[model samples]
Target chain A: MSVAMPPGSAFLPLSVSLRGARLVYDDLLLFDGLDLELVGGSLTCLLGPSGIGKSSLLRLLAGLAPRGMSGHLHDGSGQSLRHQVAYMAQQDLLLPWLSVLDNVLLGSRLRGEPPDRSRALDLLARVGLTEVAHSRPAALSGGMRQRAALARTLMEQRPLVLMDEPFSGLDALTRLRLQDLAAELLAGCTVLLVTHDPLEALRLGEHILVMNGRPATLSALPELPGAPPRDPGDPALQAAYRAILRQLDAGSR
Target chain B: MKARLWRALLTLAGLLLVWQGVVMLGDLPPYIMPDPLAVGVRLWRDAGLLLGHAAVTALEIVLGMLLGTVLGVLSALALGYSRRARRWLLPVLIASQAVPVFALAPLLVLWLGYGMGSKIAMAMLVIYFPVTANFYDGLRHTPGGWLDLARVMAPEGRRWAVLWHIAIPAALPAFGSGLRVAAAVAPIGAVLGEWVGASAGLGYLMLQANSRMQIDLLFAALLVLAVLAVGLYFLVDAGLRRLLPWHPANPATLENG
Candidate 1:
């Protein structure tokens, strides 16, 4: 059930444009004067090497950007952003003490909704985790935990989701399954994903932004060519991956 | 399982043998180092009176634990969320503990008189520290991701519900440890207060028996105190396991899960 948008509140669409964003830490510039836009209802993946501020950019967008950063996001709709965003951190961040179902229902609990246990159950089933709903994160395999985290992110009914290497530690098959699941659930929302894998960026991202350090900046933003839930072997994905890799390799040199 | 049971039995036998050997070798006198069997016999003979005293002590311990837990949680919540309160109150709490229970016991007895009141007060004091520290630390260390989730999830309304539903459950493990530590230390405080001055209780009984050179009875009382402490600790531990059944320590099987 969609909650009534608060009175005198503005609703920010899924689109986000970062104008002249910069961030610094301890006299070191993580990102400087970066400009980017994530079109509404699309998945944008930030792909780059380690220490390239990909995650830092995601953090900035989440409004949790650490001290010493300035950025303004211009949503297509003139309304200010509401609290319609969910974040999946680098770690699974599942409460180890809670069952998988309970963890998924956590967002509902925090939202003061009568924990939609059925939503949690359905999300678990979508991730092929119905059998493990009552299991703890610690008891489940790594992939299962990630799936649970994904379920939690989706259960929030947010319009925007930020994922930081959400599938980093999973095996290839598990990663593919989760990638599909994410695309399905977030069909109508925007996603900002940060990852190091070109394949992951190509597999899931509609727009790919490659970043680099030493005055971190976006090296490339390749427009992917495919429909929703693109296949791995799509010709456009291969072309985009190759083009993005050249920019990344050229930047490293 | 067999190995653990065997190890436990061996350890018990070893302890029993050491006690017997000590009594035989010391042979100083029955009034001083009574044999384990003599201690057991004395315990059996006075079981009725000892049980009565034990019941009172147990009641004081349970009540004090409940009171101390409530105080600890309230103080932890206040201190954890408020920086100014933490700065002022935390030091006072530490300083309070520095004045050892033994030194304060007599004063407590004089103030409250020789009743259960002084013992419960002592127990509350002893149990308060671990509970406060552990709970406060837990609340302070709740994962940042969860808080962020709460903010995003409840932007429209119901802030308190978010904190209680998200933050409190996240801190349960630390809360469990705090209570367990507090429960373990609680009995010691009660016994110490009883020692200072009491007309009844196992601690008082031990003092009386010791003064009369009934060493076996004193030992019996000491054993009962140890058992009570262990029992209380395990009871809290069991409760923690039951509450957080999905905790890593007790991995739920597929059926239970």
Candidate 2:
């Protein structure tokens, strides 16, 4: 389904820089003076082994990093990045009580702003969730629930989106479809996606970064050719995948 | 549903048979422990008197539940929303539970008089804690993911939005639990107040029947009170189920269906 962009929905994408980021969890350093940067309006996939503070780095960018994690986050606009960011987590996190439509409008409702119902419905329709807009999240399938979550994230109309393994919970087929939908919907917005899957990164990321080791540091791999939602069977993508696997394997040791 | 009802009826029948067996085996006098049959006969004979007293007690319990729930919800919201209120009111709320309602019954009667007012207050006092404590716990324990979502979604200085849209709704099932416990114990406060000082209610009837050695009538009163408490509990449970359609009390049953 072709997703229609909401009227006047163009966003000025924000480039974020995190420097001297230090996180000590239970006295074990996670990120010691780590530095990273995101190019404006590009999807950057961060792959790391479990417990390597991948999610924490995304949280730091979303301004939700745990207390005692010292860092400087510059959005290059001399403004706080909090208002400019939208976050999507592994779980759909749709409030069970709210209908799909209400969940889409949640960002507006939470901000105490008047919700544009027609716009929310339009977003839902784009995500192919028009029929179940009035149904509760409990009534939705995992894929449909994430679609609704994506709609909610889009409703925020933020320039920077940080997603932590947002599609990892879905079945392979559903996850692949959602990656395409997310790529199409999140175009022109700077995104930091943290994932454990190499293929997911190869399929969606414009720039792939691997974070590994004690006091984890980020290393950039060569940028993939062509746009995201690239074919998984493509030889270049397969080659990138093997390289990422080797990098992750080396990081573990 | 039909099967459930049948099982409930069977259980009641079994309990009644046990009561009758005990009385018969003990060769108990009617004054000491009237047979189940005697209690049933007394219930039929004094149906009008029993119903009147029951109405009084039921009224007290219902009114008390309403007042207590309102106060409890307000206090929960206060405690959930304000750090200052949580610091000051939480201690007071906990202390209120520590003071037994039985000890407070006499004071309630003295202050609110030997009428429905005292009984209602006693019932309210009995139930207020469960409702407040349960709801506050619910508010405090809103899922971390949801709160994180709210922190990102809601504008700064609009904490009320998060509490209203997310925390309160998330906490409702817990609040419903508190309400159920409150409903079960509501009768205790009202009955205690009646026993302490009252001219009406089943509790008062129970007291008078005991004094007059009408053990069967006393047993009849007790039966009606049990029916009232159980009936009220089911009523509350049913109402809550309807109100919170999103919160399935038994997800397994719902899934099976």
Across all candidates, the chain A TM-score values are 0.87, 0.97
lDDT of 1 by residue, B1-257 (tens): 58767998899789989999998987758887888899889889999988888888898899889999999999988887678988999899888878876688889999999999999999988888899989888888888877765665666656567557766776777888899889888998899989999988889998998898888888988888877888898788878888987555443343355
Give residue A179's error in model 2 in angstroms: 0.7
On residues A1-253, what C-alpha lDDT tens digit does candidate 2 reach at each position?
Answer: 8646632148776788988999999989988889999998889999988999999888888878897687889887766787888999999999988999999998888887899999899889889999999999989999999999999998888988999999999999999999998999898899899998989988999999999988898999998888888999999998988888888888878
TM-score of 1: 0.90
Model 1 pairs in collision: none
lDDT of 1 by residue, A150-199 (tens): 88887776777889999888889988987887777677677899999988
- Candidate 2 local Cα displacement, residue B175, angstroms: 0.4
Error of 1 at B107 (Å): 1.3
Instruction: Give the interface RMSD of each candidate.
Output: 2.1, 1.1
Please tell me which predicted candidate would have the highest lDDT against the true structure. 2
Badly placed stretches (over 4 Å) of model 1 are A1-13, A222-224, A228-242, B1-10, B156-159, B249-257
**Prediction-by-prediction clash tally:** 0, 0
After TM-score superposition, what is the CA distance of residue B194 in candidate 1 from its true location, in Å? Answer: 1.1
